[model samples]
Target: MIIQRLDELAEVIEVPLATLNQHYLDTNFKLKVPVHFARQIEKGNLNDPLLRQILPSIDEAKSVKGFSQDPVGDLNANPIDSLLHKYQGRALLITSPQCDIHCRYCFRRHFPYEQAKKRHWQTALEHLASDNSIHEIILSGGDPLTLSETGLLELLRQLEQIPHIETLRIHSRTPVVAPERALKLDWLAALKASRFNVVLVVHCNHPNELSDETKTLFEQYRRADVTLLNQSVLLKGINDSAPILKALSKKLFSQGILPYYCHLLDRVEGASHFEVDDTPAWQIFETLRKELPGYLVPKLVREIAGEPYKTPIIKTL
Candidate 1:
C-alpha cells in the first residue's frame, strides 16, 4: 500500500507521525531510509521543508546541468512502448511506471512514464515473442512489484507462454520500501507457480535498511524458491566508504542474498549530488576486495548507452 501521508502510515504501523517526521528532520532531511526500502511512504507535499530534503524539488532538478530526459538511451532501445531490447539475450519490460516511493537519485526520474504506460502486456509480449534469442525477460520500472498481484500474475502467465524466455528477473525496491508488500504470501506463491525460472533483484544501499523485517522478507523469497540478489548504488554521503560497503555485503550475504552489482550513479538529473568519481569508487572497491571474499565483492559497473552489457571499472594497480 502506498501511504501518501506519514500520519496514515503511522496509523497503520501504530507509530506516531510526528516521530517519523522528526526522524527525517533530525537527519538533516537527508534520505534516512535505505534506498531499497525507502519508496513505500509517499510524501504528502514535496515542498514540505522536511520532505524536500529527500524528495526532489522541481527547481533542484532543473538546476542540475546536463541531465537528460532519457539518460541511458532508453529512447533508442525502446522498440515497443513497454519493451527495451538492448542486450543480447535479455529484454527489459517496463511493467509499471509508478513506484511506492520516489528516490531522488532514480535514473529514470525524467522518463516519460505516462507515454510508456500505454504499452502494456500486449505490446511487451509481441516484442518478447518475436525474439527467439531472448532467454531472459527483465521486469523493471517504477518498481514492478507495485503492480497488483493480479496484474503481475497476468504478466507472468503471458511471459510463460514464450518458450525461449527461460528466466524472469524482477528488479524492484518494494521489499525495501514496503516490507508489507513483500509479506504478501499470495504474491510469492504466484511467482513460484510460474513456469519460468524466477530471480528477484533487490536494491539496498545501507546496512540500516536490512532490519529483521527485511531479512525475513528475503527468507520468504528464498522459501518461495526465487533466486535473490542485491544491487547497490555508489552514493556520496550514503555509502561511498569501504567499511559501509563491506558491512552491507556481509549483512546481505548472511541473509542468503548475493551482492550483485555496485552501479556508478547514472548521470541523471537531480541525482548529481550522489555521484562518486571513478577513482574513489575503484579505491573503495580495492578495499572491499581485501576485506571480503571474491563472491562478496560486487562488480563496479557503469551503464553506457547502447552498450550490450555494463562496462566494468578496471583498476590498474
Candidate 2:
C-alpha cells in the first residue's frame, strides 16, 4: 500500500524517487492506506499535512535520542497476551493489528504484534470475565472497525456477557479515513443496542480531515445512542497552531463529537518528526482555550514512560 504511494507521491511532487530511497523510507512496518485517504492528499504537495502522516520518508528510519521501542511501557503493563491494564478502571484489548491506514506517527507501529498474538479471540474475553474490577474495555489496534461485522458483533456479544464491562471504547481512525466502514456497520446503532456504553474515540488531527462525508458519518453515529469523542496528536507541522486546534474542536462539536485529548506526540523511535515541545504545546492549548468555550478545549497531555495515566502538559489557569 505504502510502496504505491511513495512512488505516486514522488511522481506527483517531482521529488526524485532517490530522495526517498527504499532503504531509509521503508520503515520496518509496512504502510497501509485506503484509496479514500489517498484522495485527500494535495497532488504535487509533499508538505500536505495529511500526506506527511502516511507517506514513508527517509526520516522515519533515523534513530534519535530518548525514543524507544516501547514508549508507553505497553510491554510492562500487559497482564495477558492481548490485554493491557494501564489505568485503574479500563482495560485495553488489542483486538487485531490490522489497520486500514497506517499513520507514520503511530506509537504502536513498533509494537511486537507477533509476541502479543492471541491464540483464540476468546483469550482476552476469558481474562476480562475474571476481572470484575475492570469496568471498561477499549478496543484498539490496527482498527477494530476493520473487522467483519460478524466478527465485531460476535466480539461485542461476548463482551456483553462480562457484566462488569459497562463501557466499550473504540479507538480508531476509521471515521476520518474510512467513513464508509462506520456507515456500513451502522456502528452506533449496533453498539448502542447492546448493554455497554458505546464510546467511539476517533482520531482526527486536523480539521481538514473532517469533511462533509465524515460530518454525515458522525451524524449517523450520533443518531444512535452512542457517545462520540475525538483525540488528536499535536504534530509539528500539522496542527501545532492554536487556530488549528480550535477549529478542530469546533468542527468536532458540530458533528456531535467532543474534543477529548490533544496529545503531545509519543516518543516512539521512528516518529520523532511529529513531536511538539511541551512548552509550545501548552501555550497552544492555552491560546486555544481563550478563543473557544472551555468544553471545546481539549486537555493537552503526554504519556510519560511509567505514568499510570496521561500527564497534563500545563495547569489550566
Candidate 3:
C-alpha cells in the first residue's frame, strides 16, 4: 500500500496529526511512501533518516542559488524521448517515470517525465543500435523495476538484439525500498540467461534500509550471477558522518552488495538543505578511509552538468 496523505502516513506510524502536520509540505511532488518502507520508520520520531528523505518539507519553499530544476543537465543531455546519453560507453534509458516513493532530495524530482513511455523505447533502442560506441545501457527511471515482468522481459529482449551492447546495468531504488516489486522470478531468470553482463545497482542511503527481505532478495540476485552494488547520496544529518557511513558499508557488504558511490547531493532546487559542504564531506571521507578497508570505502563523487564522468570529490578543502 502507498501512503499519499500526511494523515495516512501518520496512521501507519501511529503519530498524531499535530506533530506530523508541522513539517509537511503539500506540493506538486506529492507524498508517496510504500507501507513496507514506512514500517521501517521509528514512529513519533519525525526526524527519522528514512522519513526525512521522503516527507515533503516546508524548507522546499526556499529559493536557493546554484540549485536548479535541471541540476545535472538531464534535459540538455536527453537526445531522444526516453534516452539520456551522458557518459560515453553508457547511456541511460528512462524506462519508467513512476517511483514507489517520491524522495524529496531526488535530482530528477522536477524532470518532465511525460515522454517516458514504452512507445518511446523503440526510438531510444534504435539510437542505441546506431551507435556502436554505446556498449552499456543503464536502465534508470523513477525506477525501471516498476515495469511489469512482461514489460521488463520484452525490453530486455529488444536490448539483447543490439550486438554492440555488452552490459545491461540497472540503477534502481526498488530493490532496497520495495523488494517485492523488484524480485520477480521471470526477470531474474532472464537476467541470468542474458548475453550481456548484468549489474544491479541499488540506491540505499542508511543502514536501517537493509533488512532480511533485502538480504534474501540480494542473495537471489547473486545466485543468478548478477553483480550487486549500492550507491548513496551523502545527505546532511541523514548520513554525513563517518560512523553511520561505515556501518552502512559493512551492512551492504554483509548482504552481497558493494559500496559503489557515496554521491554529494546534486544541487537540485529544494534539495540544497541536504548538501554537505566539500570541506566537511572530504573530512568524513578521510575518516571512513581510516575506519574501513579500501574495498569497503565508497568513492565520493558529484555529477556535474556537462562533465564526461562523475567528478570524484577527493581534494581536501
The candidate 3 region of ten consecutive residues with least summed lDDT is 11-20
Residue 157 CA displacement from its true place in model 3, Å: 0.4
Give candidate 1 regions above 4 Å deviation. Answer: 1-53, 57-64
Model 3, residue 17: distance off in Å is: 1.6
Q: What's the CA error at residue 275 for candidate 1, in Å?
A: 0.9
Preferred candidate (TM-score higher): 1 or 3: 3
Model 1: what TM-score?
A: 0.84
User: Largest lDDT belongs to which candidate?
Assistant: 3
Q: How does model 2 fare in lDDT?
A: 0.80
Model 2, 1-317: lDDT tens digits are 22345566566545566664543365567656666666666765667788778777678877899998888899888888788889988999988777888888888888877765546457778888998999999998778887777778778888899989899999989889878776755445577688888889999998878888888888777777779999999999998998888888998999899999988888988889888887777788778878898999988888986787899886544
List TM-scores for all candidates, in order: 0.84, 0.92, 0.98
Off-target runs (Cα >4 Å) in candidate 2 are: 1-5, 8-24, 186-188, 315-317
lDDT string for model 1 (1-317, tens) is: 44445555445444466655654322111233333343322334332322332433333434577666577898889887788889999999988887766666778877877777834669779878888999999999878988888788778888888999999999998786677775767778987787878999998787766777888888889988999999988888778899999999999999889999999989886667678889999999999999899999999999999888999998854
Residue range 1-317, candidate 3, lDDT tens digits = 77888888998887898888888878899999888789888887888999998889999888999999989999999899799998989999999999999999999999999977878999999999999999999999989999999999999999999999999999999888888888899999999999989999999999999889899999999998999999999999899999999999999999999999999999999888898999999999999999899999999999998999999996776
